[model samples]
Target: MRTEISADKVKGDFLEKVEELSGQSIWACYQCGCCSSGCPVAEEMDLLPNQVIRYVQLGLEEELLSSKTIWLCASCFQCFSRCPRGIDISKIMDALRQMAMEGGVDRFGPVEISPSELAKAPQQVLVTVVRKLSA
Candidate 1:
């Protein structure tokens, strides 16, 4: 597979964008592992919550984008609430996922559906299910 991996490549604007959306300074992360421990989906993730933060800090954009951990996160807010650093890990994940999708990073494969893809599905069944669950 063709690939690209570069460290310390995060553009300043990219960091600013993420910081703006997450309301957490990326530098504030202390790697306490609390986010990973509290994450309900961490066991199923390719990268733990703390690992994700580390990747972002290192500017490992491709690594972060290719990781399934972003999708695995159910965004239940446990990580965000339990974080001692007060870093909004969920929001950071959310920002990264959005940016990755916009950049056509292919974090999820062509046939694999990320949650964002579910919104574009022509079938109403999944939407109905989500609605019922959210209700």
Candidate 2:
């Protein structure tokens, strides 16, 4: 929650890195809720798609990188389809995931899970987990 925004933070390297990685204009988003509204996994996300863009614009690297929302994105492109600015939220999420992994903020790995838990997980869940880890 509580984040301190300063001029330096607004113009930090984090913002540039995200933009470069995602290849999207982070400032193009104007807080419109269309991306969040159309996100299929919005209910499962800690931060909505639009909020993630806002965080990037503000250069809140720690908060953005730590969010589960980035990992939750399914890259279905629903947000991109609905965005008035044609922003592809999935690319942004991918960039954030990359940044988080670079910072050693991995959620978990298959090696860390018990065999019993792994067996209990659905096939789709396991596949997604493996995909995220590999990415």
Candidate 3:
């Protein structure tokens, strides 16, 4: 989707808090798109890693929280390693996901899963979902 955000429209304070919580500075990102280019799942995301950083910088909390990218992220740190500024983009995604869950998005949805279905899920997926939702 095409979008526009002016500097005055950005929320400086929220950006500061994200940095404080994640130990990664939003200001450090230069919008170089390196993070997005390097992200393995970037093509599958509604918003690329670089765009997510911009949303965080602009304090688009609701948009960021609702994005599919937050769930699609593998947290493999490929973007972090590729970043020229060394920003931990995965951590930021994690933080946004935590916020989303806290904002009432169900991790497993409203429908109750059968015990057999739950048992069939991969152990790693279960652990990751639990960790992200609990954060």
Per-residue lDDT tens digits for candidate 3, residues 16-74, read: 76777688888788899998888899879999999999888887766777788988888
- In candidate 2, which residue ranges exceed 4 Å CA deviation? 112-128
With candidate 3 superimposed using the best TM-score fit, by how many Å does residue 84's alpha carbon deviate from the native?
Answer: 1.1
Best by lDDT: 2
**Of 1 and 3, the candidate ranking higher by lDDT:** 3
Worst 10 residues of 1 by lDDT: 126-135
Tens-digit lDDT string for candidate 2 (1-135): 788888999987998999899999988999889988888888898988888998888889889987889888888898899888988888999898988888787776767668997879888878777667544
Full-model lDDT, candidate 2: 0.85
Best by TM-score: 2
List pairs with backbone clashes in candidate 2.
none
Task: Return the clash pairs for model 1, or none.
Answer: none
Could you tell which candidate, 2 or 3, scores higher by lDDT? 2
Better structure of 2 and 3 per TM-score: 2
